[model samples]
Target: MLIYAHRGASADFPELTMAAYEGAVEQGADGFECDLRITKDEVPILWHNASMLERAGNRGLIAEMTYKEVSRAYPQVLTLDTFLDYAIANKKGVLLETKHPVFSGNRVEELLVTALHEKKALAKIAVSVMSFSWLAVEKMRRLDSTINTTFLMHKNTPWFQARFSSSAAIGPGMNELRAEPMIAKKIQSLGRSLNVWTVDKDADIHLCQKLGVDILITNKPAHAREVLGYP
Candidate 1:
């Protein structure tokens, strides 16, 4: 399985920052994964939370601030454009997760599609849009079926959701997969690929390998490489 850095080697560096992605590349990650959020000015930015309190120590909502304002609040912040440029330059595959239920509605998916189309990212590297919201995945498929989409599953997500989704892959948390190993076969049975998230443990890594997971998302790419005996 290919090892994709979760939030860009987030265990060693701040999540969704340039530093994190840089660390990911240095650690020999096959790809990069990030969470995308839009600012008030419609600029796509790499951010995981609606409020900046967790990462930036500011209480302001990201959707209410422009990119400039966000930069001022947290200078290390990375935009989607900036991240895409870095990924393209480094020849890294990209797995972009569009956070849903935001104030901007489905504008995130639209902007992402526009950016990918303008950048011709599909021609250069592997790119997949993933989301926990089934509607968001469907929206992405509608916006551009050529681009791949993955429907993310959490503890609360229905098992049958993946069967009906338009996504090319099904993403389940490592814990979910551990609890139900059959999920792997079930996903494969649907003719969909498996992309497991945040798989950090050695056992989890072995499980992913045994189950033929297509992509293994993790915070420690170097360690995963070591565990998998990859030079």
Candidate 2:
């Protein structure tokens, strides 16, 4: 099992902040989760929402601006390349989640692979296909079948099982883990790894550890690690 820092140890620092990611690496997080969306100019930036306007202090939308425009708007905001650079320098693995389905048909994987190879970080990370659209994961598989992929789900059902074989693992929603223990077991038995997401409390971390999930995605990885004795 591994501990993945959700949004780069978001509870300690601002979500998606470079400082937060740095903190995660120091705490021995095996990997970090990051969300990707496009800027107005079609440049992919590290963001979790449809826009970054909510988190920006006295700033405009990250999507309404070009890459350079966004840089000026939120100087602290990190582009995908910038974030990956830092992760590579620190040797932190990343679970890059694709937030946009329509535009992420195939280009997302291309850009990510190209950037990782260019920065010599390809083998250090895994690109996860987290879109509601199955087509996104299919595209990713097409891009590179070797790239580890995961399906984000709230439950296990026939629909999920049909596509389950294609994924390397499944990321169960935090709210559904205990309620769907049977489903989790089934997923694990299928030879696919089980990972739980967005767990923040100490109790939840312990519970996830008890379940033997392959990865516990948490906002407080350092604390969760302490609770789990992950180091």
Candidate 3:
């Protein structure tokens, strides 16, 4: 199973920062997971929420500010291109999560696809775009069929519905998995890989392993690797 660092070992370092990503890489994580949003300039940047106040002490929405403005306010923020370049240079897989309720139509997806294409990084890295929005998943498929996509869910969206969609994998929250353990088997039964998210505790790690998930998204990559006996 692949161990992906959620927000790049976010438990040890600030989430979505270069420090966190490099920390995860140092921990021997198989890959890194990130959440993204588009700036006013239409450049994709790594950020988890709509507002930057909590994360960066900036008092504006990411969509309302240009990349230069936002970066000036919060220099720690990393652009999609910068992060992708790091991933390619280090030969690490990336699970890129696109934020929902996108206000810029399909522009975010388009920019992400264009960036990957421009670098010719797709052939070298195992990159996958995931979202809670099925429309985004469809848009990703339309943009590039070869690009892997996953449907993220916290609620009980029927497997039959999502499995038949363009998504090649299912990203279920750890809480959802805890609520219904058998869902993993059902997902695997459909020949879809199971990727669980935000798994940080020891018990959660063991549970994901017992379920035979294809990937474990966690903020504690070092701990997870130690638990799983991964180098």
Candidate 4:
């Protein structure tokens, strides 16, 4: 299974920052995973929350602030463009998750497709889009059927929803999988890849490997590598 850095080695560095991504590369991760959000000016950035109060210590919502304003508040912030450039330079794969129900509606999907096409990312390295919102995944398919997509699943995600999804892969949280190991077999039975998320524990990492997971998204890439004996 491929080991992807969840928000770029986030256990060691700040999430969605360059330092974290650099740490991921240094730790020998197969790919970089990130959450994408657009600013007021329509610039795609790497961020995970609706409000900047946690990461930036400011009350500004990401959709309400321009890139400049965001930068002023949190200079360590990374943009999609910058992250893509670094990934391309390093020849590393990327998994982009677009946050849904945002103030910008479906603009994030449009901008993401535009950026991927502009960068010709598919021609260079592996790129996949994942989202918890089924509608967002549907919109992504409408925008670009060629792009690979994974429908993220939580505990409450309907099983039928996953069964009917057109995504190439099904991303389930590690907790969900631990509770129901049959999910792996069921997903594989449908000929869809299984990508588990935020897996940090050694036993869970081993379980993922044993279950034949396609991609393992984790906060500690180095630790996962060690646990899986990847080196």
Best by lDDT: 1
User: Where is model 3 more than 4 Å wrong at Cα?
Assistant: 156-160
Clashing pairs in 3: none
What are the per-residue Cα lDDT tens digits for candidate 2 across 74-99? 77677788888777777667788877
Full-model lDDT for every candidate:
0.95, 0.73, 0.91, 0.94
Every model's TM-score: 0.99, 0.87, 0.97, 0.99
Q: Please provide, for model 1 over 141-216, each residue's C-alpha lDDT reduced to its tens digit, 9 standing for 90 to 100.
A: 8888899999999999988788899999999999999999999999999999999998999999999999999999
Measured by TM-score, how close is model 1 to the native structure? Answer: 0.99
The candidate with the higher lDDT, 1 or 4, is: 1
Q: What ranking of all candidate models by lDDT puts the best one first?
A: 1, 4, 3, 2
Where model 4 places Cα greater than 4 Å from the true spot, the runs are none
Poorly placed runs, candidate 1 (over 4 Å): none
Clashing pairs in 1: none
- Span of ten consecutive residues with least summed lDDT in model 3: 156-165
RMSD (CA, angstroms), candidate 1: 0.6
What tens digits encode model 4's per-residue C-alpha lDDT throughout 60-141? Answer: 9999999999999999999899999999999989999999889888999999999998999989999999999999998989
